[model samples]
Target: MGLGRGLAIGTLAVGLLVTSETPALAGNGPAYKDSWRPVKVRVADLLGRMSLDDKLGQMMQAERLGVKSPADVTTGRLGSLLSGGSSQPTPNTPVTWADMYDGFQKAALATPLGIPLVYGVDAVHGHNGVYGATVFPHNIGLGASRDPRLVQKIGRATAEEVSGTGIDWDFAPCLCVARNDRWGRTYESFGEVPQLATEMSTVITGLQGTRLDQPGSVMATAKHYVGDGGTTGGVNEGNTEISEQELRAVHLPPFKAAVDRGVGSVMISYSSWNGVKMHAGSYLINDVLKKELGFKGIVVSDYNGVDKIDGKTGFTPEEVEASINAGIDMVMVPYNWQTFIDTLRTLVQQGRVPLSRIDDANRRILTKKFELGLFEHPLTDRRFLKTIGSKDHRDLALQAVRESQVLLKNDHHVLPLLKHGKIFVAGKNADDMGNQSGGWTVGWQGTSGPVIPGTTILQGIRSSSSKVTYAKDGTGIDQSYDVAVAVVGETPYAETKGDRPQGMGLDDTDLATLQKLKDSGVPTVVVLVSGRPLDIAAQVGDWAGLVESWLPGSEGAGVADVLFGDYNPTGKLPVTWMRSAGQQPINVGDGRPALFPFGYGLHYSRHW
Candidate 1:
């Protein structure tokens, strides 16, 4: 009379008979499969039915490349799938994304237990991985806006786009309190201050909505845990050599705020804390984050985060044991996830990893899955697909772009560019959508050119004025031109590639372009398109006007709005502007003489 997993066959048969399309339709299924039952009870029942392979598979997150076909989801019993920065489906359309999600979901349903696989993507700046998805300003620009409500709205818009694709997880709101602007990922932070990061945690509420089961809601991730922002020499994945108190004060507040908002997951950092790798840090992951702070959500490892624990090429068994013991509920093996699955199974059987730990992890992961209603509605919710790059969302991005513009210098009141005057625009970045959007755009590190649809800074200026001429190298301008606008600064890069180890000065081409405009006798207004503040102290005084446009994403009109007096400049410095590259690690309380202090910004005296 009993079923295969020891459930009464008659009860199971009855539960199965009344189902709609999805497995747990209207909570009608076996006790483990029932949606209406308490999540804990369902989790327990599911745990009881899982074998070693099943449990291990539930903890492994593989890249799309690792899976040969959609059937791989059921064959490997995989729990999750992700697209790295450059990874996308062929023809890369919104329809393609939905098809991919449904295909994978169908494969997951074919598994013996019918557990759905959760899909995660780095929609860090407005579903950025998707083409034509209305790219918004990056985090540093949002930080300048100093508008949590605006950020929350962005989060909501992002959730709708992600939900339209049938993706359920977003690895976003990189909450590192960037102590050094030289750090490659500084743009990912809201600001250098703990308060800024904490306030912006409203994005979590935006992404997850009032409840996880809501129509447009997606699970948000608080990532690169702990001290990635405070790494020594601003090196990527380097050591953060700070005392415990300093670490707690500067970097921990945003995460706490995220937990307060009930974030569903926390991705562990690849960096180290005082020479100890964070992936193996048991105190922070288990004792502090899980117990003291009381984060009941899943703790996921960063992309191949465990590989660097032993300072080796590939991950090791010791690394696996250390990471798992440190309370990493899920491992992002990315490629070779099957090896991870096999190794973890071996570790459990050998008693290196206890079965109880495995059970606890599964309990947490499955609990979220059940709470999200993934069992009943595993396919794409196509209703929200129309929201992608909608006019309303782009308008919000424009407002964000306007608010994020910081007026560093407006000498002799030369700004508030007149709409009728003849203008000359120059610089490699002035007309490129990819340059303004910065890293994590169409590609991983982001390439230069028109990679996506959006208003370029040149386009914004052209739209506003009747007479506008553009030259790439600041040529074809004389006294006849009223002003010369030179958009010059760092191109695009993320993480390790963005770090400036030897020097943080402008490149030769940028310097040459600036010199041409400065020598032309016309008032030169410099619009810096960069991820972080560069060492421009030597030549900053030469320009009549200076504006910090921190990777303003798709909407360049926001910068033009401020320039034309349509919007007053209000953005403050998120990180201190360095006097020289020597002040690499300068901060607010550090007592170092800065070119521009943190939280400094200028406004037009005459309001429009």
Candidate 2:
């Protein structure tokens, strides 16, 4: 079963799915502080006049705005606010989002200089905050394309969506060269290949736009500073055990690519390299990334990454200051800002952290805002709310969904599903956008119920197919069906909650579900949803047709389009599908076991 009339069917499928309405999750909520409109010079001079409390406030970024009202920008000295995906603006809507943002800017300006507050969000894939930003292909999909221009285009698109909604900084262009397929953040990466990461660095060109130092352009953030993708046992947030030389060879290339292209921000990772946390290690963050790489941009910590350093070295704030003296500029203190302020003040008062250090950090932040042209064009056209989930952006997602489907198994021409075939769809994942998008969708560890409105795989398939039956993990087997597709894979999970250092893979229950369908003597098709490839060896044989749909974005209906013979599968594995946890740290490109070489995927063929 090869792709038949793909272009013809794709055109039809897109026309149908294009009509679906998905709203942005953010709302305006109440008034926020820091909505100041000061000139750049005035903002800078204002920073100079601020006391230690006020200056420290400028460095902290929280999940929400810290102030209770508009009076707090200069009064309370709050610096920045961010939405951690799940943290929607109250009364969430596109207008409220703009209003909330303007509120923050209002406060920052209330200060003498009236500087605008730079709002940050994980708009990595799209205006992920606002419901309808064009959710492009994940970095992994872009990796498979090997098209730097496409990556840059995505960067531009992402910037336009995010900026149009009032966000000034985008924490994006995930520079991690995903060495391990088991890592949950795999989809967030360019690929396991260094060259792919190198190519994706072009995203900076899009995020920051053609000019590096310009307002209106969202500042490009190169993330996880060092070897975060090479975590031990493919764990989410764990140690990366590699020599610095090895690190420089494999993981450092992408970040360097961003640095070369002028990324405005670098976010520190939670993981450590060679027993030192990337955030805490003076040698890597300071001497290496800051000095050697010539990354003049501001370096910010991953959310609450400062806490880990104290946990690791039993170091107090003074030690924290030493890390700052080492290279780090701003801290993403998600909570507990008072401690950061008190500690920094104590450090400066004791001469442990110099005024020069504070000035340097503040200068970098201001310089980036200047370079990003944030001061000149601090406000985005809230009017852009009209275009939030526009037809064009959703079409881009459909294009990505069309491109990102990987043909993993097609035995005896069993796939490129026939619309007339009596197919039975079984699995909890079949209809859920939460499962398809995996981590970092509307919420951090996505769930199956009440996903921000979008067409699901089940909905798409039913719309296209003449006959279909659906069931969750365990349900009545559709005995009369000619084929059964068990759309299933890993659920939305992250960090230690989703972490499994030992024997990582899918659960036996999910495998048994496939076995049940296979035992029924039906040709089974398995459509998998996962952040990273799991130990599917036990389950692959149970299905005649297998597809590795690595967290296809809001356009998962495109997966159905390709699967149902509406489109051909063009996606290849961004990271190798490890046979088991033991074979991990798996990459299709390098140091991989013989189980499956890197770049092992089948393109759709007409042959049965």
Candidate 3:
């Protein structure tokens, strides 16, 4: 209702854009007659019709239920609402999600222009929203593919399912080129290569596909803007002490690729760069990225990134104004938008921010709304909403799961899991859906328990093999043992907490567990589910087989497909399994000596 008509861009290339005094807009009356126009024209018309409070509503985003009461949905100035991985609806069902989306849209639509409110979810892998949507490999697995087109295909598939659920935006394609393998988010990048990161930017293009105006496609956000992946000491929200030139050349390349692809939005990072918080870096945000890179898109703040920019951090609420003046168009307060609105309004009234600055941010966001044709088709097919995780999508996810499995070791003949022999499945992860999914599943750091409902490795093996038994300990190995699949890897974690494998391989507990199983006289097939390669060379030598499952999501059953002779494991390590954490940032392409070089996957045509 608010955007009036939609904004437009004729071709996929960023070059087809027409620069406006502000950003793109839809202008008044109808939607796109043609696909190349700024959204400002439409937004200006909508703004003219809206009350002061309504115009202010366009500035903030919150959780769907974060507002104190349902009435808060109509609070006029709230621009967007989101449900992070953990934030579930009251009923927490497909029906509930749709109802929430429609209800919020109705509130925003009730206003004069009927602008629909933007509803967001962390649909990192498939519509992880609808319980059973086929969750594919996390970004790390895709990184190993080294195939940008495949990443784009995955993005396109992700967008289709997400959009089917009545959501229009996705926070995806984290462009950070992981500098330190120890970072918890190491799996979230397209590996440590800047060029590969640049190529993966095409995922944004593929998500939206040929027409940005299409209903099936969703807007892709190039995220954690500059140098977030390079945090020193591998801590989340830590400082990146690289030079400006290094920042531009190394970290900024993928973002530039995103902008070039006509990416509608960019999420500012939470980390600092060169001892400066990225949230407050006016020169980089406004000058280098916006002006120099010629990026004509909406700049959004990361979850609470705006707060990190303070007077102590060299920027006041007023200077924060300078950030928006520089480039930021929206703030994702996530939990409390009212606080943000109060602060932003106070800054503007106190003359800390100029009218032009406010207009700049508003225009940039409104342009995207217009270009997306949101005003024209506010409601998606409710029928498809019921079709959340269809069989076809699950097939796609299964394929990705197989494609992502890397066979890291095979001493003589350690695998294919022997269809006839008894297989001992041992490890905490072997039976848990949550452990295999890793971080960013149903929760932010994901969680430990039966996360929605996905097949565990044990179940997959049982279904495939004639005989399979499981245990946290490999008990009774003497009677049934031919091979024991000691599944191990990182637990569900995000950012800092997950990154520290306590100087051990991810799921270092696996070492003791596997050793216990190995000591039981069972030839072990160690399967690691980690975001990055962990130094498990000793563990590798101890085992007859080793495999890196790289945070495989809902379709973990694919591991069984390859393990049980249905398919062959073809994935290679996207990163080197370092000798130790001290070998931080060591990669195959780095020309540095490593315990296990990158591209080190070895596939056996036939098993022993």
Candidate 4:
């Protein structure tokens, strides 16, 4: 029977209340319900009892909107639910998230087999889906820190926040080894170097923790499996036209590192390798990733990734069959999930997809579920909910911001402005939290406004100085001010929308701000808040000091830490700073002239 509708799931920030109607004792259920047995034995026992419908459901991952009601999870025997980039529950609080998770999880447990659904979210830089969660620096900012241990700590903190809301999996640590900064997702990559991405795989350990069953630990996913960063023209989901050797050399190392750390899942990229869709690349997905790399974890598809197999508007039977056979264990059918379930079931029944393949997918998925201890404990661990935006997490985030501030130019040491002097702060980004946090923030292409809690650069400056003023357009500035700080550059963006199809110069607003500061005769310090380096060579010469702040999420105080010499500037560029926008895909060893080379950074005490 279908469950009741409008089940008044309230905010769980206070605490969760498991209804008295939950199922009977574990003694009544099969041996698979026993938590003490080895995961494989339990998996096998559970597999024997599951029907074809159950197995098909285990292979499908539906988005939150796709499920009509909580009962749909039980009736359909669905295995997973994901909240897409912008998808959040009503009230959008941590409490709401826990309630929503428990609601869906309760439905899954009502089935005959009572297999728990593994919920996933894109907690790339924290529990990014929830409001008031600690927003750490994006990967580019972390990469500049060159501290894998710190990255791992951030991962652990993120996992705790995610687990508090009952999410079991995170699609994170995008080990794409971004070869071109022009790609909009470059900020998501650790750096351009393979070793950098490889080293940062410590985050995998941090997310999964010492053991999968550990409290507050969530399964980690090393995503966009291979060659996504090497795409020509730095296009999102575009083809990587490189040879297999080049692909192996540049892109495969990070995935290897992730595998070594026992990451629970690997997401296949939407981009093609050598003009062949990764979704249908059987040799790569099955032969290489599964067999060669020995990635025993479930291989998940990107959002609607299988639909692009035939390069069509909708998926065909051929595409579904090919993708499954090619080794995609879980299809992220964000919508139209029932069609996927039916198509796969038809293929398996028709023998186009083998029973062995179906068993393999179920086995891999169930193993993770068992390893995650979902059956034994299927509710939110609310102890960590309070830790979402706790002061400790924000302090760590502040440290990350401090280490990510790359000093690009400091002509004659005009920085570290005296606390007693008159200072003027101006720019569209100076007092904006949304702009500092960049993309994958509260919303998907993150808008610039007071969207979340955090100190603005201007606020940081004011707190650090006795005399300071802010002007969004550099109004009321004179030589009377000891220094003019112009916090300007690119605003918030993500994915293809962030790609620079036009020239990469600063906007007119920023240019005007800089011009006013430059003409004021006060020593000018330009703090650029951007995801990637831009064309600033012409105007950079006019500034007395320049800092590449990247996207210092949630901690403008860290930027102030460097500006006041409380923390020395140590962040190096993670991507090459191009001389101009025309030099689109410039890199360190590419024989092109860069305004600042990769790994270039300076300190107040260092000789330029």
Runs with alpha carbons beyond 4 Å of true place in candidate 4? 1-29, 606-608
Q: What TM-score against the true fold does each predicted structure earn?
A: 0.96, 0.87, 0.90, 0.94
lDDT of 1 by residue, 1-608 (tens): 12334233323533544324544334435666666655665676677778989999999889887799988899999999998899889888888999999999999999999999999999999999888898988899889888999999999999999998899999997999888788899999988889999999999999999999999999999987898999988888999999999889889989999999999999999999999999999999999899989999999999999998999888888999999999999899889899888888889999999999998888889878987889889899999899988899999899999999999998888888988889999999899999999999967899899988999999999889989999999888788999889998989999999988888888899899888887889999999999998999998988999999999999999889988888989999888899999888898888999998989899998643
The alpha-carbon deviation from the true structure for residue 94 of candidate 3, after best TM-score superposition, in angstroms, is 1.7
lDDT of 4 by residue, 1-608 (tens): 11111011111211334355422212333547756445665677678777999999999899998899998899889999999988889898999999999999999999988999999999888888788998988999888999999999999999999988889999998998887777899889999989899999999999999999899899999989889988998899999999989999899999989998999999999999998999999999899899998999999999999999878888889999999999999999988989899998899889999999998999999999999999889999999888899999999999989999999888878877788888899999999989998888888888898878888888888899979988899999988898988999888898889877678889999998888888889899999998888899889889999999988888889999899888899998888899998887887788898999999999889432
Report the C-alpha lDDT of model 2 over 1-608, residue by residue, as the tens digit: 11223222322423423222312111232111112222233234444445777677777776564445556555646667677867777666667788777777766777754556778888767776565556665677667656677667677777767766688888887888888666767778878877778877888898887775443367889988788888887676678998878899889888888889988889988887877777778888777887889988889888877777756533378557856776778877766655677788889899988887887787777666656555556666565566566776677777777777778888988888888888888877788777776666666665665465566788888888978888776366756888888887777765556665666666776777877787788888888776666677766776788887777767767888988777777776667767777776666545657445556677777743
**Candidates, ranked, TM-score:** 1, 4, 3, 2
Candidate ranking under lDDT, highest first, comes to: 1, 4, 3, 2
Give lDDT: candidate 1, residue 529.
93
Q: TM-score winner among the candidates?
A: 1
lDDT (CA) per prediction: 0.89, 0.71, 0.73, 0.88
Query: Which scores greater on TM-score, model 1 or model 4?
Result: 1
Clashes of 4: 2
